[model samples]
Target: MFQDEARFGRMVRIRRCWAPKPARPMVGNGYEREFLYVYGAVSSLQGQFDWMITHIMNTTHMSEFLAQVSSAHRRDFIVMVVDGASSHKAHDLVVPENMRLLRLPPYSPELNPQEHVWDELREKEFPNRVFNDLESVRRQLEDGLPRLAANRASIRSLTAWPWIVSINLNAH
Candidate 1:
């Protein structure tokens, strides 16, 4: 929802571009997939105390991380969580034991600040992104995370989402 590209794609396909003819051209291998999700946080303007957790990368991971983060931050002042994953409720993977998960509702990405952080991170830092393989991309993301941690504001924004920063506190 950060840039609203994916949602726009969905909307266009559903509305503007309806199917009619059986004749069509195949495009590429159809292996390209957009794995989107980020651990982000929202500060109370001044930015002192922060809520953090392990970010959910994919749907499989999102449910579990969501469950874990929800539990750890249940009592915190920063208990609000904003997310737009259908799997968060439909899939048990997004929900952990003893944790309550909340959804950002449909077509509501603006509520999630983490989306903005991820957009900035991807476009600004990972410009002209090219990777040899999935492992290469994974390694780059891992490397960027630690660096992201250094920025209190960014980290706070990044983990403000439900399933990222708080999960770490649970592990300890």
Candidate 2:
């Protein structure tokens, strides 16, 4: 499984919008810097995942998210590929019994498939939009994640890299 966290907030980007050619251009709402962090993991082989949203991303939150993922897949061992965030390597990080973390090389976000999940979330679910508050953003995340999780084919298409597939095959 690949794991990562993405920060989404009221900072809206200008995305393509449709309007009459002679009319005024589309405008995005002003950026407000509030943020919510989403911690997520994807199992490419099974197209399954677990996620959590929190206000902060630190050792404590990381530990909590790990526990959630661990309990969800307690029957199987999980080799989680994650970025080298400080929180991931915190000295006191508590890894669940069923999972272990494998840090990707520094500056290699492309190697982690979970990064694509964040891109999809931002582009598709919350594009060019400003939330009224943190709670609204949280609600969108809550609704959006499950929709993503339920789309197994979409998840597989997004995350099933050939090298990852070969690695899994070799492992088995």
Candidate 3:
């Protein structure tokens, strides 16, 4: 599984919208710095994923999320590829027995396909909108994540890069 995190908040931007050829001025409700963090992981071969929404991104949350993923896939050996975040490398972080983490090279977000999941979430679920509050944003994410999870083909197309496919093929 490829792992990553995304942040969503009251800060909203007006994205492209359908308008006449002479487009009218577009307006957004404004922005706020308050945010929520979403931890996500995706399986390249099957497009399966697990995610958690948290108030903060820290070692505790990472460990908890890892535990959840491990529980969900307890029967299978999991090789989770994650970025070199400080929380991920925290000394107190507890990795599940059946799962191992592989840290991607520093500053290498492009190599982790889980990032695309964030893009999809933002584009489809949060575009051109201002959320009333943190809970409102959470509600939208709660609803949208399952829809994205069910879209196996889109996940596969977004994450199954050539090198990822090669790695999976060689692992077996």
Candidate 4:
């Protein structure tokens, strides 16, 4: 599984949207700095996704997310590909017995399939929208993530790079 963390917040990301005829479309923009972190992991071959929304990003929360994923897939030994975040490498970080972390090279977010999952979330759940409060943003994520996770075919189509598919096939 490829894993990453992303920040979603009250800050609006303006994107182009359709407006009828020549009518100008208006989008609300907010400068609020509040945010929450989402930890996500995706198995490209199986179209399996796991995620957790958290108030903060740190070793403790990362360990908890790892434990959650580990417990979910108890029958499989998972090698999770992750970036070189400090939390991922913390000396005290707890790694579950059934999983191991493989660090992607620095400055290589494009190599991770999980980044595409985040892009899908932003485009579908957050496009041209402004949230009034942090809780609103949280609620949006709380609602959107499960919907995204349930669509295994969509997740596979979005994330199954040729290299990933080839590797998985070769492994078997």
Best by lDDT: 4
Q: Can you rank all candidates by lDDT, best first?
A: 4, 3, 2, 1
Clashing pairs in model 3, backbone N/Cα/C closer than 3 A: none
Regions of candidate 3 where Cα sits further than 4 Å from its true position: 20-25, 169-172
Candidate 1 global lDDT? 0.44
On a 0 to 100 scale, what is the lDDT of residue 2 in model 2?
Answer: 96
**Least well predicted 10-residue stretch by lDDT in candidate 1:** 6-15
* Per-residue lDDT of candidate 3, residues 1-172 (tens digit): 9999999898886688888878786666856788999999999889887899999999999999999999999988899898999999999999999888999999889889999888988999988888778999899989999999999998999888988888743245
Clashes of each: 22, 0, 0, 0
Q: Stretches of candidate 4 above 4 Å error?
A: 168-172
lDDT of each: 0.44, 0.89, 0.90, 0.94
RMSD in angstroms between candidate 3 and the native structure over all alpha carbons? 1.7
Q: Pairing residues by index, what is the TM-score of model 4? A: 0.96
In model 2, the runs with Cα more than 4 Å from the true position are 20-25, 169-172
TM-score of each: 0.51, 0.93, 0.93, 0.96
Best by TM-score: 4
Provide the global lDDT of candidate 3 against the true structure.
0.90
- Residue-level lDDT of model 2, residues 40-153, one tens digit each, is 999998888789999999999999999999999998888988899999999999999888899999999999999888888887888778788989999999999999999989
lDDT of 1 by residue, 82-146 (tens): 45545444544544444444556677776666555555556544544544444555565566655
Error of 2 at 74 (Å): 0.9
lDDT of candidate 4 at residue 123, scale 0 to 100: 94
